[model samples]
Target: MKRLMLIGITVAALAGVAAAAPVSVEIATEPGLNVTAPQKWLQLFAEIGQTGVRIRGMRAGERPRLEELGGSRRVVGVLTRRGDLLLPGGKFRQRDRAALADYFDRVAKDGAEGVEAPRGRFDLTEKQFRTAYDALSEPLGFATKDQPPRAVVERVRDRLPIALEIDRAAERTLNNAGPLAEDLEPLTVGAALAVMLARDGLALTPEHPRGGEVRLRVAVAGDVADSWPVGYDPPASPRETAPVLFEFLSVEVEGFTLTEALDAITPRLGGLPVYWDHASIAEAGVDPASTQVRFERKRTYYKRLIDKLVFQARLKSRLRVDEAGTAFLWIGR
Candidate 1:
């Protein structure tokens, strides 16, 4: 098995590092894709993010799939170098337009595009896009691939340019702190250690409008460690700000999972309101599992009501219509 080969290398390294009767502890996870990683936080996370963490082993094939580790049931295709997990969640749809558009304009501009289509192949014209519907268009998928619109992603072993692909989930961690990664690395390391101790998952929530969040599962061993968020200003977009991720080795958190710290510090950690109607509208417009709507349109209609009043020899006709009758018709919109 590919996993066996990948493990062979790590095991060899561990053989030397940990010697006979290494301090190894195993835990049973309800989530699949169990990690038999190193006891060290750095080594453990490094391995999980490396090429060895594959569907079956290190290499990803056409039909290659994710080992569905935790959180929601996800069937990640193949991971790009930056740890971006492209879900088989299908494509984007009309309702998902805003999110997808933001993704293309923001994150996509920074990472690689896992799948390909000629420039503007989806529809170069907005008018055409409005009339075209595809499940691949949906911004994100929360549950099963059977969901109306799924993520249409390609299998890849390496990272794509930010312009082509960015881990959308990670986007949520972007924050006002400027450069997220710069400050995030230390925090990540600390969180890795704490989560390892707690036997929990690490979730990063956005601290501000400008930043995004990324969630990581614990896969190593270690106790409390020192960590801190050394701020760095990330590149600014016309509409948003960027938070640093990190490289600061000194800032440390004691005995806390990354999620716990993020929950304590991330500006938006609890919950945010999402419009279900938006997803429903997107689903109605696109479906990859069945017939996909390739054409979309938006329709608007107005009706005028006339009331005539006659006084003496004078007759007057007036039309009155309120905005209440006004409706936004997304039908083929």
Candidate 2:
């Protein structure tokens, strides 16, 4: 009885040791392949495991070997035309194997565009490849809600120049009205304008300089603009400084009349008074309570919102600032 109990203790200790053992993955590389590529691929595997997985790279003529270590887990494989031949460690379950396979496939398809591998394989673009590599190595942990709206808009604006131009034009128009509307941030307004332009299937391409001035050509899905809003002209210049109403806002409405939309946003504008050019609206027969407006939950500026309202109502606005610094809106058809 004593001998049997001692033997059982020994077996239990061995099992514990095996469970705590480290896992390693070995990859064989072809000649002339970038050394860092293999390291990146290994890092991605480590990310999926949520642990530090060891990696070993073998050079050409070194036969790839995968063996079950007495007390450690390991993965062994090589990239091939058919796919990766992955051998998971003893600690890895069937589910883990599936997840690794799926991740590898995604990396190959989306990330590898012009990447050159050892076996004359060139599949991943440099950007795609780098992004894939960083996914495993660099983890972004911030929640989206914690991010500022203006920062988000700036990122989008940098990618689209036409969007920037549109925002500038809107700012100029709002500044012309003076104190009636609040100040506009180019990035925030640009992002909103970009979304609107995309919805209309419109794209703007700036033409080469002609006699010292540049003109923008509008295209709709690769075709010349045959139908667009009439009587639209680009604003002259964007204003640099003005009063700001709200720093950031996310508004969404559909099937709401222009007046109702304004009413809804008025409370959020820090009690800044709004005045409309009643005479111009009345003369043009524009009914503020009848025009429908729709906006999505994107970071927006007050001036950008006003620009949208005026465009939808088929009217123009002028800013009038009094000597007392009070701002008023004058609407014109």
Candidate 3:
């Protein structure tokens, strides 16, 4: 029903602009597949108008699914030889919207020359990779309610020292993942972003050209096998990085959910933040909210208790440090 309303709006908008605009855009979709909203379509065409294309006529129509159009579902704009652009059904972020306009403008003028294929590899020297990885250690905090991942990433990017780029396909994927709800404690910028992105099956991978600048690329997790980890090993010992976890504390839990155990131990960790591998847990079908766990120790430290709890839940805990040399707990399979 909502989709039908959207399609109606698209056709109406097309009719409203058709006589004035030279270029036409066809909004493509498959049954049960989603596409961009009418407002975004209008905004995209407005941006494209700035590109100075000769206006002719505008129209809206549906083609096959993106797969049938020889494009990935993650792709945004598909320009045809007839100067018509077909956009797959999906939401678009500001960056992606602008990217599409610029892309179409170029293709319309230059006949689709110099378009780069979807990037599959990121080459970086060991030092270059390390340099970018170190930036993840920078301390950061994130709190959002019903915000898209792309917007959250843009906020994070403004505060980070490292260069980060969201691939077009990845941007579409993130936007499609819908609004994110997160309230994370202070972790490194990398860890915070990693946790948020994990929920969408996305990841941040570092890249650098020889003698060039270092940057991090956000791509689908499966697409980039060597993406940055949720957390890295702490530079110092557990006692130094997170002394609270090592402090003596008697603990007992016959059957407590993962969240329950974390609640009891979080404050004791002495400001050590904890993050979960959202993608991994989802794929493994592990629901921390209801995953019952048991760990009893007459006399044990918080670290020991945490280990036992996660192990029972079929998860693991890692002591890692962010770029700021702050300690945090990364729990996942």
Best by lDDT: 3
Superposition TM-score, candidate 3 onto the true structure: 0.56
> What residue runs in model 3 are displaced by over 4 Å at the alpha carbon?
1-122, 130-137, 141-148, 160-163, 178-182, 209-213
What digit string (tens of lDDT, one per residue) describes model 2 on residues 1-333? 957965764564344331223445565544445555555555566666624544454455555344446555344555432334343221222235565655333322322221122211113334433432232122112222333333423344344322222334433332332221222221122222222233234443333221111223334423533322211222321242224542556666677888888878767655444445444576678888788877766787776877677678897655543222333343456
Error of 2 at 38 (Å): 99
- Per-residue C-alpha lDDT of model 1 across residues 1-333, encoded as one tens digit per residue: 857965764454344331111111121112233253212222432333322322333332443232323321222343333333333332333234354334333222212121222224322223222222121122222221221110111111011111112233322222111211111111222221221122111121111111121112212112113211111122343112211111112223344432233333333312211111122223345321232111112221111000000111121211211111111111110
- Which pairs of residues clash in candidate 3, taking residues 3 or more apart in a chain or in different chains? 21-56, 22-55, 22-56, 35-89, 35-90, 137-322, 137-323, 137-324
Residue-level lDDT of model 3, residues 3-95, one tens digit each, is 796576456434432121123344432333223443444566676564322222233562412222222112234333333455443334445
Please give the RMSD to the true structure for each candidate, in Å.
Answer: 29.0, 24.0, 17.1
Give the Cα lDDT of each candidate: 0.23, 0.42, 0.63
Better model by lDDT, 2 or 3?
3
Off by over 4 Å in 1: 1-119, 123-125, 130-235, 238-252, 268-333
